[model samples]
Target: MRIGILGTGNMADALATHWARAGHQVVVGGRDLAKARRLADRIGHRTGAGDLRTAAEHAEVALLAVPFGAAAALAGTLRDALAGRTLIDCTNPVGPGFRLLTAHGPSAAEQVAAAAPEALVVKAFNLCHENVWRMDPPVFDGRPLAVPLCTDHPAALALASHLTRDLGCTPLAAGPLGNAALLEATAALFITLWVGQHADAQAVAPPLSHAAGPA
Candidate 1:
């Protein structure tokens, strides 16, 4: 996969490095060329670096790792470059109190899609910390990390699934793009439980078999 990462932040660093290590061609792009170059250097493995548009045009699959507040505008501006490409939206719209910033509006993924109407947008990778993504395989308790994806495009879903498996994680089809708000809201709740309440967010649910009461 030729992966373009549109940010120079922790999530970009964490996930891009893994894909690059897995033999995928990676280009890191940011508003600041120097930051993008620095991130590329850190990712190593002959990773590419450039300004945002350059990276956008170089990708078969693009990861929108930019801040949630800036993503829609950036996507709108890069609409032409992103057309026909599979766009993975990993941003969480959580405010200072771990609040769901989108509230009753469209989810962040939907906003990005609306901004870049021609892009095949997929919502994924927003459920975990950057450090968890940095893990070599992210397996825990004998189970591989399961990544839930929401996308209306089949090709976009496949691309996202491939990337998830590249990190040795399972990709689950959560639903189409319409359900993205649910995923974003879930992220907010999990963050609140994990950080604000200092609780194990994973413990909030029972295993699959026990989800609807005893079998």
Candidate 2:
């Protein structure tokens, strides 16, 4: 797959590196050409680099790895270029105090979909830190990381699932885009617990076998 990354940030670097290493064609684009070039070069594997529109137009699957504030605007700007494409959103709208910034409105994923109405938008990969994504396989004590994706489009979910597997993680169908706010809100709560409270956010939930208790 030809993967275009819409940001030259940590998420872009981490995910794109894995994809490129997994034999996917990756083109990284950012507002700054030089930064994009540098990242693309670092990702190597003949990765391409250009401005944001170049990336969007060059992809069958585009990763919207931009900051939460910039995602909707960029998607809106590239609406025509993104038509018939699959867009994977990995951004979290957690603002200061670990607040879900889109609490009163649509979730960030929905906003992107509204911006690029013709594109297949999927919300995924927002739960983990970029550092965790950089962990090569992100398995813990033998269990590979599970990436939950929310999207109504089948093609978009397939692409997101493929990418998740490329990182040696499992893909979980997490319902449609309407449920994205739940994922976003969960991120906020986890962030608050993990960073602010210096607690183990993962420890808050029991394993699947214990979810219903005394399994």
Candidate 3:
């Protein structure tokens, strides 16, 4: 699949790298042309420029990897171009410095859908950190890392699962788009726990798990 990521941050770059390594064409777009070019060159895939519209316009699947607040802004900007396309949302709607902001209510995915009603918005990849995604995406224990996915479109959800598997993580369909609230809340919990671990200087979560227990 031709994957276009909307952010040039570590998360976007990590997905681009892994997707390119998996033999998929990946392109990155950001406010900084130089940064997008640099990441595209490093990934060794076809590169392009322009605003979010241009990036999302030409790709088969567009990954909304921008910051939480920025995601809705960018989606609003790309509203016309995103129609009829599958949008994989990886943003966490956290408050300042990754605090809970929008997870308790409608969730970031639903917000994106509301902002871009024509697009098929699916929630995925918000639970784990970018470092874990870049370095250790595979599960260490018996269970696969739980990357809960919620989407109303079956085709889009399947594509997300395929991409998740390609990137070395197991995908669990948490339900339809409305279930995004649960996933988003789970992401907040993960981030909170992550902060706690870093504060205590203990071992972080080895990988992700799809088990029934905690995040």
Candidate 4:
């Protein structure tokens, strides 16, 4: 798979490393060409660097790793280049106090979709810190990390799921794009618990057997 990463930040670097190592072609792009080149160099072989539009136009899948505040505008700018492409949105619009910045409006994913109407927008990878993604396979307690994805497009879902597995993580189908707000809100709550409360957010949920009643 050819993957385009639209940022030179931590998430972009972390996720692209896994994909590139898995034999996928990767293009790291950013507003600053030098930063993109540096990131590509750090990722080593099979990865290249380019401008944002060039990256978006060169790949079948594009990952938007830009800041949440800038994502919509960036998506609008790349609308034509991203048409009919699967765009992965890993942004979390959490403000101070770990509140959902988009509390009263569409989710970060929705805003990106509205900006690039022709693109298949998928919400994923927003639930964990980039450091967690940097872990080799992100396993904990003997279980591989589980990624929940929300997307309306079948192909987009499949691609996201494949990438999750590429990192040795399980992908949980969290429903369609309409449910993305739920995912974003969940992220906000989990971040608050993880950071402010210094709690293990995972403990807030019961095991599947328990949640499924007397199964």
Q: Assess every candidate by TM-score.
A: 0.98, 0.97, 0.86, 0.98
Worst 10-residue lDDT window, candidate 2: 206-215
lDDT of 3 at 16: 75
In angstroms, the error of model 3 at 90 is 0.7
**Residue clash pairs of candidate 4:** none
What's the C-alpha lDDT at position 143 in model 1? 97
Candidate 2 lDDT over 1-215, as tens digits, reads: 99999999999999999999999989999999999999999999999999999999999999999999999999999999999999999899999888889999999999999999999999999999999999989999999999889999998899889999999999999999999999999999999998999999889988889899874
Residue pairs with clashing backbones, model 2? none
Clashing residue pairs in candidate 3, if any?
95-99, 145-208, 145-209, 146-209
Cα error, residue 99 of model 1, in Å, equals 1.1
Q: Kindly list the per-residue Cα lDDT of model 4 for residues 16-98, writing each as its tens digit.
A: 99999999999999999999999999998769999999899987999999999999999999999999999999999999889
Better of 1 and 2 by TM-score: 1
lDDT of 3 by residue, 1-215 (tens): 87778988888878878888888867688888888888788877455544556679877789998888888878888988888889999987777665678744687888899999999899998877787788645575655565788999998988899998987788899899998888777666666666855442224344336334585
Question: Which prediction has more favorable lDDT, 1 or 4?
Answer: 1
- Measured on C-alpha atoms, candidate 4 has an lDDT of 0.95
Question: lDDT at 97 for candidate 2?
Answer: 87
Ten contiguous residues minimizing lDDT sum, candidate 3: 199-208
- lDDT scores of the candidates, listed in order: 0.96, 0.95, 0.80, 0.95
- Global lDDT of model 2: 0.95
